[model samples]
Target: MDVDIEDILAELNTDSTAVDQSGNPFSDINNNNNASTLYNESSSYPETNLKTNATSTSIPSPQQDYNNLIILWRNERCAPELLPYPHNLMTRMLSRIQEQMERLEIISMDFLGQQHSTTTTDTTGNNPVNNNNMLPLLCMEAELERIKFVIRSFIRCRLSKIDKFSLYLRQINEENESISPLQDFLSKDEMIYYESHSEILLKLFNDTILKHLPPNMQAINDNTGTVPMIDEPDWNKFVFIKVIGPQNKIFNTDPILIKGDNGKWYYEVIIPELQERVELIIDSIYVMRYKVIKDLLMEGKVTLI
Candidate 1:
């Protein structure tokens, strides 16, 4: 077959003009170019790939949660006057008490001076008839009345303040129950006032209620191997045990053991013979090491006979 090269070139040119002049195919070509550019850009810089890996953490234990709860309670519950009450009632009560105490002290001092003066005057046989009996009794009675008044006033003031504080606390508790979880009624100023009031209340509570409690109730001094005991004469006494040699091992041989209701063991040893009780003050580090050993044994971290 005889090929016509000129004819074939002419046909190709005609097809190209037809494709471009129609506008549809030409626009399709431009759209494909734009689509290609967009695809390339999107693939080159992927949005999902830019994200960091998410990390999962374990939740805290129940004991840790409980401790957090207690801390929050201490922070929030200590100040009752800030939310609702006779405003600055605690401050007023404290000031009144102090003033009354001062007055009582002054009255006591004056009475004491008067008595001393009278006794001295009588010793010198210079007792005036008026000073001997009537004046002293009258003065003493007046001092007594003043003291009684102060005492009664102090008691009444304290009672009133306490009653008001209690009522406010109850209101707060009720408000807490009724309010929405998302709602916060306390303003910035109120929060600041509450914080200061809380600190004052904490100090007062510690000085008054906490101080009067038995020492064992206030703090757990595990450093001093003092195991609380019941049905024993010296229940509060700390027990000590003597280690003879510089050895790391604790043994059962002649080891003084103070056992509690919880089956916890403490060493009991008498020091300075004259001292009535046996008490040992263990270093915190040693106590911690001992605790680790104990925990290891309990948890099967170490095998023992």
Candidate 2:
């Protein structure tokens, strides 16, 4: 669990490449090429059919979808309560896409109207005909296409993350108070949306996989804690552990018995929530009473935060 700082830095620098410490590709929202690559990778899973309902004949162009996602992501931060529910997010985005398409139609009508008025003026000899009138209209059409493509790429970047890290967010939602600091990202309404979605997925996973388990293993483990269960690997990853009380002049260090090196593995971890770092001690370190950092990042699956 001791992560190599150099390895972490290297991954951060070359995030566009598909190979990380685990050989899986990392998410990069600025990359466009990753859309097709991620789609092809995720397509092998029948459970990952993420497209909107196909009953509606009007399909949104990728650009329009991307634009709506960006707008939604931004709005979620400012007005989390008003953010659309998970089931409705895509529907709302599709509506925005249709609006963009409608603008194209209006633009076409305006062009025709201008052309008709120009023809009348030319017939009266007020002005000579100019082919350049179409230039600005043509330019506007071209610009809209370019905008759509850019928006599509941006959306694909987020979609790729959702496709890959969904397992973490599967059980995360409003009612699950066990996960710490979720309030850092989600609002009350958004939490309800995700909680319901997580329940559905959790039930599906349990139903499909539980039947195959041995009779003794059929019952699920409901207890989740920071303390390791029997035979569970002890976490040695660097963490920000705060002292339970105020720091005084007298200090004593506990003997290092865990995995980290006595001297080399110690780090001054900053706790922004506490606004300070505490003195180091192997045993006195304050791990969360309920949730541990390892479970938050690794197992409990609250990835977005």
Q: Best lDDT goes to which candidate?
A: 2
Native-referenced Cα lDDT, model 2: 0.36
TM per prediction? 0.19, 0.31
Root-mean-square deviation of Cα positions for candidate 1 versus the true structure, in angstroms = 41.8
Write one digit per residue (lDDT tens) for candidate 1, span 33-134: 132222111112222421221111112221222222222222123222221211122222234345535544654466566667778767764456534433
- Give every collision pair in model 2: none
Per-residue CA lDDT of model 2 for 84-152, tens digit only, reads 222233433445446545655765676566667777867753333334544544554565465556446
lDDT per model vs. reference: 0.33, 0.36
Candidate 1 local distance difference test against the native: 0.33
Off by over 4 Å in 2: 1-104, 114-131, 170-204, 215-305
**Cα-based lDDT at residue 95, candidate 2:** 50
lDDT of 1 at 198: 52
TM-score of 2: 0.31
Clashes found in each candidate (C-alpha, N, C closer than 3 A)? 2, 0
